[model samples]
Structure formats: structure tokens, C-alpha cells
Target: MWCLLPTPLCLISVFLLLQAPVAEVFLYVVYKQNSTCMDFRALSACFGPPVPREGLRGYLTEAAPANACQPIGSPPASSNSSEVFIALIRRSGCPFGVKVLHAQQAGYKAAIVHNVNAEQLVSMVADDKEIRQQIAIQSVFMGKSASKHLKRASRYEKGQFWSHLLKYSAYIVIPYVIQEFGFMINVVVCTITLVVCARWYKKGQKITVCTFKRGDKYDTCVICMAEYEDGDQLKILPCSHAWNTHTQILV
Candidate 1:
């Protein structure tokens, strides 16, 4: 038997069933030597909110229980107020969503769950509806190799500071330099245009009363040899030669 759902019920089903695609998240790790920074794109979980395009930054710390299948403790206290912590948990013991929920409960900004073995990265799917609904912060799955590299590099602070310092400085400086360069180019273009107009105005032909001295070359038309009369109009060439307005010089 064929049956049609009511409009309201259909709309509700669509809203509850559909899942929007999330953008990929790239994790940055600052190395121990000279703050050299390298980045790896992790697979986002089926659950949790999408990370903002600009992304989040924090120091990496291993989960208290290592697996994070149960409730974990809060992040370690730091004197620096701006310091935020992210939890690193190995993949095992429970579903991905449970691990993420534990990390979220412990006041971490985000969670990175890595593979237990050296396997290719896979998307972390929510095991149950209850856990998925409880998780809020962004959670991503990392490969074993990348996670090992991060664990080694997380011990250094000098490299992280300088790498992030340069990154922030570029965000502010690059736009300002581009704007100043554009303004200078516009000024140069306008100056050149004004100079060309001024030169054209000075060299252009003009109409004036015949008030020049009798012996002056401008007193007569150079092309027609016609003597100038009072109120006679004169056409001036760029070469400073004058002629009657009606006269036509072939060359």
C-alpha cells in the first residue's frame, strides 16, 4: 500500500536525517628546533561541530587515562591566561564518541584521537545517538605516524611561540602593505594625467583680440600672409606659429 507523509512530518524527517558536510581541519605541530612548524590535515568525526576556518591553537597534552574511555580530569593549570589545552587520546577501549565526550568534560578545547596501530587514517563515526548528542567540541582522527611526531615535538615551547608569533604578525602586516601600495599607484596615475592635461591646455589654439605689436610675427597669419585686424581670431600651433582661424595649412 502507498502512503504519503504529511508536509510537517516530511519536513521534520528531513531536518533530523540530513547531515551537512564539514570542512577538513589541519593540525599544526611546532618542532623542537627553531620552532619549525609542520601541518597535517586530520579526518573530522561524524559528530561534533565544524571547526572555524581560522582554526584553534592550544598545547597538546595526553589524556589522563590514556584511552579516555571514562571521565578524565581537567586540564593542568598554567600561569599564562591565554594558554588553552587539547587532549590527545589513543584509539581503543571504547567508541570514538565516548573518548571525545570525556575530553570535552575535562575543559579541553578539542580532542585528537590517534590510531593504535600504524594504519591509514579513517573517519571516526558516532557509535550511539546519546554520545553524539552530548559531544560539542570539534574532534578529529589522526594517523599514528603524525601523532607520534606531535608527541615528540610537544615538549618544546620556544618553537611554538615563534611560529605562532610570525603567523599572527603576517595576518596584520600583509593587508596594510597591500593597501599602501595600491594608494601609491593611484596617486602616480592621477599625477601623470594632470600633467598631460596641463600641457594640452597650454599648447591648444586660442581666440584673442589682435593687440600684438605691428612687427610681431603673430600680427599676421603665417600660412596666408593676411595681416591681422582688430578682434581677429588666431589659431596657434604647438610650434608657436599663428594663423587666421579660417586658414588651412596643408602640412
Candidate 2:
């Protein structure tokens, strides 16, 4: 009988364990609306929508698209026409200082960085506020695929792609799993403990009340002037008296 009892309990535990992860995943998917836009290319194109320009000054000199124009409010032309200007570089490879210096040297008006995966966008600033160049900087996460495309397009030759994999794994994936497991264990343990305690308390309980006798040197309840008896339910009043169901005095 004990073995059979454990089988059912184990089955229920397993069922609950399986259901916990599914429920957690469901809640996560429901809550995280941005994860759905993790495709880096899609996110980049959305954020970096082409701004139409009328003049050729803002267009890329190498392969300027016919429709592409300089963005509005660009700084005045630089003296060195031979310098190259680029925008929207990946943030992972390029440090903020280097990007600012590059922008100043190239006379670029702005620089935007997309995240490694391009899932979200952010702005970048130089740590040293003294170098106040007339350049703006921004960042975005390009999701894995979009980041790869940008990397390839930018001709990134050095640095292994997997260098940051361990960091991501440790920070994101492992911590999430550990938190979920801890929550599940706590729920199951608490539920089982509560059930066991409730059953133990209900095993041998009796409901009885105290009986009182008149003039038995007993303290009387101020409200009802009644005395308590053994095994009889007594209500203790604030005026140093115990009251029984029947309003009789026993001292």
C-alpha cells in the first residue's frame, strides 16, 4: 500500500514538474513582446529607415543611392574630402572612443551602433566629455542574423564570432534556468508541507465545551456572570472572568 501510494505521488510530482516549465515558458512568451522582433535585419531596417534627401552631399560617395540624400542638419563640409564617413557600425567591435575619434576625423555628422543581434537600440556617448565633437551616436541590437550581415558588409576580418558566447550563455540562459528551477522546487515543497501539516492536525481532534457549577469559588464573567467547567468551552472576558454557555456561577 505504501509503495502504491508513492507511485501516485511521484506521478503527480512529475506531472506538476512538466507543467511548471510549460507554464513558465508560456508566461515568458506572453510577457516578452520584443523577443518576437529579434530578427536583426528586420529591426535594423525598421529603425534605420532611409530618410529622403534632395542634395548629393549626404549620400555615400562610393555607391550613393540615387534617392539617398544627406540627413537633415548635417554639419558643414570638412576640409579633407579624402576621408571616409560611415554610420551604423556594430557596437560590439567598435569602442565608443574610437567611434567618436573616427567621426571627428572623417567629419561625419553622426554615428549609430546596432547591437550584436540588433534586437534593441541604444545611444552611445564618449566617456571623456571634453571631446565635444559635432557628432551624434546611437546603438541598436540587430539580432544574430542582422548583426552577421552587417559584420560581413562592414568586412570585419578579425575577432572570433564566438568570443562573447560564453558571456551570453552564463548571463542569460543559465540564470534563467536556475531561477525557474528554484521557483518550481519552492512551490512543490511548500505545497507538500502544508498538506502534511494539515493532515497531521486533523488526525485526532475533539470538540467539547466546559461545564460550570454555581458557587464553586470560580471567577465569574463580568458580561454573563457564568463559571467554566472542565472540558467545557469558556470565553475569557476582559474583566478577569470566564463565561460558559449556561449563565450559572461556580467558584
Please name the candidate that would achieve the greatest TM-score relative to the true structure.
1
Give the whole-model CA lDDT for all candidates, comma-separated. Answer: 0.64, 0.34
Find the 10 residues in a row with the least total lDDT in model 1. 8-17
lDDT of 2 by residue, 1-251 (tens): 01111111100000001113223211010000112211122111112212121101121111112111222222234454542233444455444545444543444433334455445434344455543343333212223454444434333232111100011124335665888799999999999999998876664233233455554445555557544445555544434345565556568
lDDT of 1 by residue, 82-108 (tens): 655778889989999899999999988
Error of 1 at 8 (Å): 55
lDDT of 2 at 164: 9
Report the CA-based lDDT of candidate 2 relative to the real structure.
0.34
Best by lDDT: 1
Give the clashing pairs for model 1: 35-159
